[model samples]
Target: MLMDKLREGAQGRGAKIVFWLIILSFSLAGVGSYLNRPADTSPAKVNDQPITAQEFDQAYQSERGRMQQQFGESFAELADNPEYVRQMRQAVLDRLINQLAVDQQAREAKIRIGDQQIKDTIRAMPEFQKDGQFNNELYLNLLSQARLDPNSFSESIRNQLLQQTWASSLTGTDFVLPSEVTLIDKLLQQTRDAQLYTVPVAHFQKTVSVTDAELETYYKANSNQFRSQEQVNVNFVELDAAALAANIKVEDRELRDYYEQHIDQYRTAERRQVAHILISDKDAAVAEKQAETVLTQLKGGADFAALAKEFSSDKLSARNGGELDWFERGVMDPEFEKAAFALSKPGELSAVVKSQFGLHIIKLVGVQPEHERPFDEVKADVLAKLKADKARDLFIDQQQKLSELAFENPDSLDVVSESMGLKLQQSGLMTTSTAKAPFDDAKLKQQAFAENLRDTNANSEVITVGEGKAYVLHILEHKPAMVRPLADVKADVEAAVKLQKAQVEAEKQAATLLSKLNNGEDVSALVKELDVKVESKTGISRTGATLVGTLLNELFRMPHPAADKPVRKLVAMPEGDQVILVLNKVTDTDQPSAAKSMLQTQLAQGRMIASQAALLQQARDAATIEYNPLFNSQPVSE
Candidate 1:
């Protein structure tokens, strides 16, 4: 149970603080190398500690899996790009080197995490708890499922704790100076009001016209924008478990056997339809007294729902007369669940039950008996499960065979497709960014366009397209990237050139308007002359989201208006428009005590993070690191 708790806690923590600190530290320190060993055996070394090729490959694969999980099919396409792959490899190596450096430093500092500390950490994790206390059985079961033994998992936790201690000691106190806190508070509380006059590029379009020579020159210079991406057509074969399930046959005996073996899955636990008048408070004495009073009112023949509605602190259920609907054991707090379940008769009220939420007066309103679903009623579901289980087993066998066959006959996919009784599928011409169904995978595209395979016209090795799906393909046709003729994209080029000319005219007009405003001419009067409307917004802050584009940003950047003088500036927008912003007033309000406290906490946390990063960089500079040339020359998988 303790082991299970450790596994559940580890997975929930997800590599922990040390892992992230290492990654962030190395990123800022730059790559370091010590001495190069044989390329085939180790890819990197830190202070003579070799990072084995197997370790590197495993970390690389784990990172790839995480990316695939996060980005889905899109990551496969990203993985195909050489630059993205190179970045991923470098990131993996950086993390390894940084971790080694930190581990060495911790050893030298004699910062050891004791076994008791590891036990305490594991015990504190909420994942392995039942009824607000750690459960030994749950902890062990979780570890068994995660395939981790207690001793090794505990050791890993200990090391992480040691690293965390060393890091925290280096970071020191997260104290912020009084002056810095005051400045941050002032920034957060400051507000500005502005008058905005927008000059749309469309307004200047009529005054701007593109010449034929200008259009032609623009098209020639930006021809790459109109170029078509290189595309390919491929012949491929795909295998998935769902498709294979249709060919699987499950007999009656097999279905019956599966149903009997998994009978517990179909059993329903006893449930109680309960309602409670809860008096929640941090003070147990106050909550218990309130609960006693509510219970006394119920005993005096007062309507439960009416009294509950008036006194219950549980606002959500109070509206419906404190109806919590039906729930089984483990769904509610153990103390509450026990008290509610113990009442056998409907309308029976229990003594005030004390739980984490304070005190509760539980009433049993309805009951549901535990029962197992009849075999005949669930036969269809049982049969489906049996077939699905059989299909999964079959898919494993067939997928392995397919891989072996495809590798043996890499010249073409025809033989493997024929032997596997699968049809050879064809894809329409697709570019590198194609995310269409069936042909949407980037990894598949990368494999199809591999130089070795494309040059030889040979088949690709089997690639996992998605969960439980694999495919192999051979390129049938390839088209090199090319620029479209001037005639083909002349209309697009003309439109783009016209838009650019309009933006230039708009900027020139805005500059002239700013000059007039700077010379003491009122912005509203100038905007009226230009036939543009002036919009006024009050109480805009540094991070206000109402004003679009650079309007809000420009307002904050302008100096505060003195006495009667308003600050003015011309700002460009992303949509080719210009805004003449007039900072009318700046208000500095005093921050509330609660907000000031929160800000102080945030500033302290930021300072600590920065300090930790600096310490990591210092450690890396003191360590000797080296990388093998093989890291650059070899594929990540190799």
Candidate 2:
């Protein structure tokens, strides 16, 4: 969906650059240096242009945070998977290298982005605007929330603009051939009808007999698949801010001081409860005349709610007397907000006002003036805030000492746990697939299984489990990988062997049925012999939602059937069922000329994207890249 916005804006250079800025706004680069690693220790280099370790880590952390937010509790399962971590690292590193290559190419080509252009582009962003104009306070607040300083964010924007400019220049103008447009149009208008019958694998299971010798042979060949992963039992000490805050006591004076310092947090913005009778006609004169008539009726003491219900064009609000609900500044149309906020009295009504939405007769129903919360009213909240702040300060100090003590006294976590008032807890045996909290983190799991910890029982350095949480772990027990004996896995192996045999039998039966159908036999006869019903779906497009999975894909792949013969095939379903599909008819509907034009436009945009992708690949292929050995090394606890 974001790609669609980028493609749509790519028509103009300035618009394309602005879209790039919006993209970068969500990246760590746009949010400035959250990672404070030294720039000299580069993790990767693209054509001698180094990508600092800090940049890579910041990007990785940002991506991880995004995934954690998306998946919630399940994110821990993915985080602990070695394959997933490897792929994530490669993806981040590749992105950083690509960016560096693009920047280098842009510089070589003499591409430049002006300061004024950057300023104007940022000001134009809707996120930083209020009341249809740039709001400096809003802009600063947004940057602050993103952890970005103004100067660094602006520089990032400028660099991204330069890269986008180079990309645009390389793509040039994308033109779609008439033949390509015709092909796309034909595909969009194609439809098919098919008859389907399924042969379930369960039916063949009872007929399948797996001998003991066969099961033994299968288990021997696939013994590696049954081997268990290495495991470790860990003893760890954990500290969390929330748990610490629960025991903290806040004095009355502390609460009062916090309340005084953060008074703005308790202040409410001014809001107005306004209602309007809207006459939404495209013709300006007609809408204004209707609004004037409504005003006259209101002045004559006619009920506003009754008139609104009868005449207002805004259907949802008309049912409730045209009530728009409470709103603050910068939320409504410029003309409408001005008229609504200017009415000082509760019963005050504004004259007929013309807005982009047509004409409106506005009434101010009520107002809520800005005010700060009283100390007594917010005392509990203030106390909680003070406690949390104190806990965070205490955690930071304790965490630093804990890290030092854990490293210095590498034999155990006893000293650090006691000094920080933390409890040292033991864990059950954990394998690579362990999804438990704290252990679910890949970095912690890697540390728990490290050779030093497993062989020597050495304590790990302080590891960050999450925000405001850290742990130091030492291995208590180690289990090497081993395969289970045949006797231990005989039942599971027998089931697997029987399932495999059933699949083979089903495929043979499917092939025989297909062969018979290909000859001149009616498909219904075969269905009747199998005692299964055939399902008929008509007028289904390639993208139809009614048919899903492999069956739908098989139907579209079938060629148009002849008058006397239908195309037939066997499709394998995920549930181990085989679908026998007979495509009876294929029809192509004629599209309107407007649809053809739209197709051509889409094809051209797709071509432009492809061209840009090719250029980026070319740049990357030409650039020399080197990665630090530490880049792929095991992660160390922080």
- Structural similarity to truth (TM-score) of each candidate: 0.64, 0.60
Residue 589 lDDT in candidate 2:
63
So what's the TM-score on candidate 2?
0.60
Give the per-residue lDDT digits (tens) of candidate 1, residues 1-638: 99998887777656577678889877656533323333456878888999887667766776787787689887866776888899899999898788778888998998877554576688778978888766666787877644456775676577678778999887776699877888878887788888877888887666677788997899889989999888888889988888888878888888889889999778877878888898987787887888898899898887888977998888778999988856666556679889999999999999998876678898889999899998898999998888888888888898889889988898888999899988899887888777365666667767766677779777777787655788888888888789988888888998888889889988988898888777886666657665676788888876668687467666777887998889888888888888889898999866654477788889999999888787778878999988887676775552
Candidate 1 wrong stretches, greater than 4 Å = 1-58, 119-154, 170-172, 231-238, 252-389, 396-430, 447-464, 470-480, 522-531, 591-594, 626-638
lDDT of 1 at 74: 78
Which pairs clash (backbone N, Cα, C closer than 3 Å) in model 2? none
lDDT of predicted model 2: 0.81
Worst 10 residues of 2 by lDDT: 30-39
The candidate maximizing TM-score is 1
Q: Choose the strongest candidate by lDDT.
A: 2
lDDT per residue, candidate 2, 1-638, as tens digits? 99988676778889878878888876766456656453356778988878877677766776676687688646776877888988988898998898889889999999988764686678778999888866667888977755567886788789889888999888876688898888778887788888877777776777899888998899999999778889888999998878988888887888898999999888877888878888888777787788898899998888888988988887778899988757678656789899999999987889988776678889899999998999999998888788888999988987888888998888888888787788989878989787377777767777888897777768888887666888889888889989988898888898888888887877777777788777866766656655455689899886679688577777887888889688888888776777789899988866644589888888888999999889889999999998877676636222
Residue 50 alpha-carbon offset, candidate 1, angstroms: 4.6
